[model samples]
Target: MLKFFVVTGIGLALLNGWIIWWLWRALEHTGWLRPMLCLVVAVLGVSFPLLYKLGGDSAIEVWLLRAGSFWLGMLFYVFMLVLIMDIWGLASRLWAEPPVAPRWGGALLVMGLPLVIGCASWFNAANPIVREYDLTISTNDPVPQTYAQSPLILGVLADMHLGRIITAPRLVRAMDLLAPYKPDAVLYIGDIIDDHILVDVEGMAAALARVEPRLGHWVVPGNHEYISGSIKDSLDILRHSGMQVLRDQWRILDNAFVLVGRDDMSRHAFEGTPRKSLPEILADIPHAHRNLPIFVMDHQPSMLDEARTAGAVLELSGHTHFGQLWPFHWVVESMYENPMGLLIKNGLHSVVSPGVGTWGPPMRNTSRAEVLIVKVHFTQTAQ
Candidate 1:
């Protein structure tokens, strides 16, 4: 992981340098501006790395990663900017026209890219996207025996990505907002830790323990948990803080509602750590419970078909982060089921929360970081 940061930063710096060189060479006839640009590149060449070490990213090494990422994007923009300008200049010279504004504008835009990205540091450091998520969930799962006319309030939060850049403030607002729901229970879908994740796990544990719900609080792992090199430690904190960490298990409530959960499917793909399979869990489910209405709490909702076949009435999961930004939402829609909100298939209902918080960039566009407040009303149809 550390190597990833270093390599990423260095790679961007080199790429930026190359782009500057090409840009400078492209306009030798432009005189001092070309040399001046080269000089600027040389300064950035040395400074970006230094900035990376000082700040990277999160509170841990965010300064480095953020700085590196900014420069990387900057270089990419400049490279493309220059390349675009080169083509534009050629077309203009051939057809008789002054350089299009896009050329100079592109260069200027590249120059501002770092500043634009720089705001991300403070935005994440401040906004944190912590909000009250309150929902009443009522399930008629004969298995969990969760059959009730009243709503079961489920407080849900997910994907903090706390590490270097994040701080206590993030947790502070989260707790504050989450307090309102008077949640019967709280659910953390996954990705609780990252580079700038709060290191005071004990403190965080103590705080979360204070968040009393009617039934219980449960959590599941996300991709970042493994990436942060603190999966065991994180689960320990949750357990100590009084949260149930589900790994291929189901908790029956009201003899009807069931919260069946499994380890992140990606765990094996990324960490080479074998996770408990869904079949194993389904096998463990009591036969009586199987036919009852069940509400699952899996991480990703991609397993819609499998979940339906297994007889999950309502499955709640959060991993997509709802794209976290604008254009990405369009692309993310193609990836996850319903990305956010209720999605029903074959009498199997799945609600994918936009998530409690965001991952990288900490920016909200199409859908903001949020806690899901689900209101489940049990409806009994034929089997």
Candidate 2:
């Protein structure tokens, strides 16, 4: 962890330094403007990490965090735009008969593009859309007649990151969107709370409790839960919200299916304890219930093979944010096998949500915030 912090700090310092240099050049290297630009760059670069480390639950702190997050989003676009302009300038100098000096138009573009995109991204994040999928889980064994008659509507809410940025109202709005679907069960695939310190636990709980699914609300911790440094408190809040917190636990619902929740993989890193393996957890189920359709929720989508090997019919996950911003999803796609949307691998069905809330910047570009409604149908096949 210390190594990670040191490496991240050094990277941020270099990136911010480069931004300062670029801004100075874009502004024609005005002696009077350099200091002001450097000051702004330094402040915005450090605000998020510094304020987060200090940890306060005040409105000022919240707004400061917000400002810092926006800067981070802006920084990405600014850095990219500056780099592109610099490249263009170098190419022009090499190819053209005469190299032209950088103009005010370029500087304005560098400054304005991020603001415009940022506002659009902010609106995209604020208003979440509902994405629906249809899945059929076939079994040879006789199943509950009720499930066979009707498909189960499962609501997926992932990466809410409820805290200063994702307040109660946002959660309320998300719930309102899911109300129409009337999910039989709502699965929260981790990162539900960004940080306990910055969240209004009671308020979040109240917002969540307002909606009651027929089977109930089930949740598995995401990396952020452990990152929050108040796992117990976060779990308590979820319980208060009428959710069944599943940490390396399983429950047989209506004798129709088995729901398994694995602790976030980060537990080993943060708490020095590893979560139970997928097969190990499944072994605990009595033989009588083994043939029942299995649903697994592992926050990162890192264990799809394990779930598939364990005969799980469906696995739901969130945490990728599908890059949350453009071009970044490219990186996310390379990291996870099923980064976003649906994947049917050999038999195991996986749905990876881009998440319902933003993490740092409260902005989304690659994909809009979404709630997944998967209609799962149970069908019997001949032995």
Candidate 3:
């Protein structure tokens, strides 16, 4: 953990230094103006991390966190824009006539573009839309008559990093959007709360318990839960919110299907406690219930093959946030098999949500914040 922080700090310093150097050269301003501009950039670059370390639940802290987070988002765009400008300038010098790029205009383009897009992205992140998917799985064994008659309408809420930035109102709004679907059960695929220190546990709990699904709410801890530095507290608050935390555990729902929740892979790294393997967890199912279709809720989508190999029919996950921001999605996509959206490998159905809340910066450009509604149908295979 210390190593991670040290590496991150170093990276931030170098990146900020590069940005400052570019701004200094590009601005071509005198005295205080250039220095002030660089100072502002450097401060904004480190603000979020610095404020995060000096943890407090005060209003001032919360506002600073928000401002710092927004700046972080803007900073990404600024960095990219500046890099592009540098490349363009180099290419112009090498081949074409050096295009007369105005200093102020260049400055405006770097700052203005991110500002315009960041504001729009903020609005986009705030308002989450409901996306629906229909899935049919074939079962060799006969499904219960009730299950066949009524498809399972599972509502998925993932990555609601409810802390300083994502307050109760955002959670309330997300729940309100899911109300119409009337999910049989709501599955929180982790990162439900960002940090226990900054989170309003009672308020978030109250808002979460507002709508009661027929089968109730089930949750698995994402990396953020462990990252929050109070995993127990986060779990307690989630339980208070009427959510059942399944840490490498399984529950038979209505005696119709198996619901397995795996602890996030980060558990081993963060807590030094490794969760049960998919097959190990599945082995705990009673012989009578073995044939039942297995549905899984894993915070990270890293274990799809394990779930599939363990005979799970459907696996729901969130943690990717679909890269959350633009171009970063490309990076995220490179890491995971199915970074975002749905993927079916052999018989396993995996739905990875982009999530309903922002992690940092509270802005999204590549993907929209979404609540997934999966209507799962069970069809019996021929004898």
Candidate 4:
């Protein structure tokens, strides 16, 4: 259905271009510089699809998609209004004369220059993501350390669609910013690489190694981990960089804390179904371990009800890049019951980030790529 509209639109635009070429020659006798004017506009109008496709993999693509969707329609309406004014001026010219070349030329340049410049600015920006989050615990749980002290923090920067565009500089800059907080544990949420982590496996690994957290670094595989080559390769890259690859297992710290790492929700089975339900995941927590504080690492944050019911402390997730565009941002918000923020239900807390990297286009449109620094306080009261 989508391809149908795409093809039809492009085809008609091409047809329109051909007609404009013929019209340009015809308009020469009417004092219209049709060859110089309408020819350029018509060519641009016809090849808009090509421009859209080219922009899809770059930073400007994000902004262009928005302007193409919303502002483009607005421009069309404005163009129609201007055409009416031009008609009236032509009628007036039959009686008197007005300056033709300077007024209209200046007006067109003024209107068009800013749109082009706006796109150019975004295109030249070195990095699209600007990471920001306020890390604070729910002031309800009395888990010992409150906001009064610098809490032993755990951070997860996930779903970085770090491809050809988001290079080591962006990743390095992220580490430099995060290092100031001095986290105890840092986790790469998933999708360390876009299609193939191996494409820049060595470089990404070096960057991950530079991420100096005091206690440890952990990584849970995302769906993108399995794309292209073997999943083992992606896991190996993460592991080589001093990260523990927790796959479908729980790590217990003494008797007080447990971090359960589940397989990517998109990858339903590794060996067997084993009940393949939220209840099953809850059941996976050993009976003796149930009372301990729990944190969950899952790819997409599915099965929210079970996580809450089981008294999971916090569940961190990425994958929804927070619409990444204007109109699409509305759709992304509607897709989630809680949207993109902190949601705690039945004493279970969840934080879904806009993510630090992009997937479809290399650039971000509406939501800037972010590195989440969530501070979970174990407080006695809301202070």
Clash number for every model? Answer: 42, 0, 0, 5
- Give the TM-score of each candidate: 0.75, 0.94, 0.93, 0.64
What C-alpha lDDT do the candidate models reach, one value each?
Answer: 0.64, 0.86, 0.87, 0.59
Worst lDDT run of 10 residues, candidate 4, spans 69-78
Residues 200-289 of candidate 3 have per-residue lDDT tens digits of 666776766677788889999999988887788878888887799899899999877899999999888977889889988888789988
TM-score of model number 3:
0.93
RMSD of each: 5.2, 2.0, 2.2, 7.9
Evaluated at residue 304, the lDDT of candidate 3 is 82
What's the lDDT for residue 197 in model 3? 68
Which of the predicted structures, 1 or 3, would earn the higher TM-score when compared with the native?
3
Against the true structure, whose lDDT is highest?
3
| Tens-digit lDDT track of model 1 for 253-297 | 655466776788768866677776566687777776665566677
Compared with the true structure, model 4 gives a TM-score of: 0.64
Q: Which is the better candidate, 1 or 2, if ranked by lDDT?
A: 2
How large an RMSD does model 3 have? 2.2
